[model samples]
Every structure is written in C-alpha cells, then in structure tokens.
Target: MTTPLQPRNTAMFYFQAWISFATAMTAMGIGIAYLPVSAWVRGFIGLGALFLVTSSFTLAKVIRDRQETETMVNRVDQARLEKLLSDHDVFRPETV
Candidate 1:
C-alpha cells in the first residue's frame, strides 16, 4: 500500500490568507458600523455578524476535525490489515 502524501503549505500562503481574511472582516465591520440605522437595528445586525463569524469558525473546525479523525482511523485500519497479511504463513497453513 502506498503512503499518503503530506499536505504542503507555505508560510507565505498562510500569511496571505490571514491578511485577506482580516482585511475583509475589517471592511465589513466598518461598513456595518457606518450604516445609517437606529441603535437597535445596528445592534441586531452586529449580533448577526458576530453569530455568522462564530458559526463559520465552528463549522470549519468541525469539518477539519472530522477529516483528521477519518484519516487517523483509516491509517489505523490499513496498518492492522498490513500486519495481519504479514503475520499469516501461507505455506504452513493447514486449511485448504
């Protein structure tokens, strides 16, 4: 069985992704803060934005965790299968 290739991520790519996310969030916050609306409306919209951000983060984390768990479980199963195949003595087996 072939080994899985490790994912490669450069520091520059990480930095750029963080910068883009920060810039978008900053712009969104500024736009929301400056909108012509009453206090209650602004507060409601702000709350919605906060909820969206938190939920998005939670969703991303959950997805990543699930994928990692699956990868780990698959690795364990593959190792077990390999071990079983290696330990069996085909030539000395009594069963037909």
Candidate 2:
C-alpha cells in the first residue's frame, strides 16, 4: 500500500510567503506615497508593483492547482494497480 502524502509545514509556508508579500507591498506603498518623485513616476512604480504582486499570486495558484491534479492522477493510478493486483491469483496451478 502506498503511503499518503502528508502536508507538512503548510501553515508556516503560507505564513512566510504572505509575510514577505505584505512586506514588499507595504514598502512599495510607503515609498510611493512619501517619495519626492514626479506623479508619473510614482504612478508607474505603483502599477508595476501591483502587477508583480498579482502575477506572483496567479503563478502560485496555477502551480498549486497543477500539483493537486498530478497528485490526484497518481492516486487513481495507484488504486487501479492495487485492484489489478488483488484480482490476480498467485497460487493457482497453471494448465496449458
């Protein structure tokens, strides 16, 4: 029997990821709000930062979804293999 995959450090992983994302966003927001740069430059920087954060989130979600799909496929394959093995008779006398 194949052992199930256990999600270890899931909470910690998400926590760290969120913390870093928040820190970057907060720093960027503060800089944009307080920096002496021209309005156009500030707007450009803000839009760029927003795009980056949005893309990162979308990429993470896509990766996670792909992993889940792969895992489900693996589980289904395992089940089929187990069923096949169970249906086979190992000790029966063979007749030509």
Candidate 3:
C-alpha cells in the first residue's frame, strides 16, 4: 500500500475559510435576532443554529479521525506484510 500524503492549507485559504464561516454565522445570527417575531421564535431559531454548528463540528471531527485511523492501520498492515515477505525464503529446508 502507498503512504498517505499530508495535506497542506495555506494561510490565505485558512483566513478566507475562517472569514467566510464567521461572516455567515454572524449574518444568520443578526438576521435571526432582527426577525419580526417574538422572542420565543428567535430563541428557537438560535437553538437550532447552535445544534447545526455543534453537529457540523462533531461530524467533521469524526470523519477526520476515521480517515487518520484508516491510514495508520493500513501503514501498520503494510509494514507487517513487508516484514513477512522479507523474512520468507522459498526452497529453504524445513526444520524437523
């Protein structure tokens, strides 16, 4: 199996992503706050937004962790197979 390549994120890209996320969440929050409705509705909307953000973070972490685990397991298995192949000798006499 081939080794996994590390992914690199540029500072500009990171800044852009952070800015986009912050801008989106801030806009939604302001929109919800200024909505022409009662406080109950706004609170409910805020709760939903909280859930969405938390779930999104949780899901992303879970996916990232699973991928890392898979890569590590594959590397270990590949190493074991390589060691086995290296140590094996065809046509060697068997010990009694």
| TM-score against truth, every candidate | 0.87, 0.82, 0.85
Model number with the top TM-score: 1
Q: Which residue window of length 10 is worst by lDDT in model 3?
A: 1-10
- Total clashing residue pairs per candidate? 0, 0, 0
Q: Could you tell which candidate, 1 or 3, scores higher by lDDT?
A: 3
Ordered from best to worst TM-score, the candidate numbers read 1, 3, 2
* lDDT against the true structure, each candidate: 0.91, 0.88, 0.93
lDDT sort, best first: 3, 1, 2
lDDT of 1 at 8: 94
Cα error, candidate 3, residue 74 (Å): 0.5
In candidate 2, position 30 carries an lDDT of 96
Best-performing candidate as measured by lDDT: 3
**What would the per-residue lDDT of candidate 2 be over residues 49-86, giving only the tens digit for each residue?**
89988998899899999998998899999999999999
lDDT of predicted model 2: 0.88
Which candidate would rank higher by TM-score, 1 or 3? 1
**Residue pairs in clash, model 1:** none
The residue-by-residue lDDT of candidate 1 on 52-96, one tens digit each, is 989999999999999999999999999999999988978985967
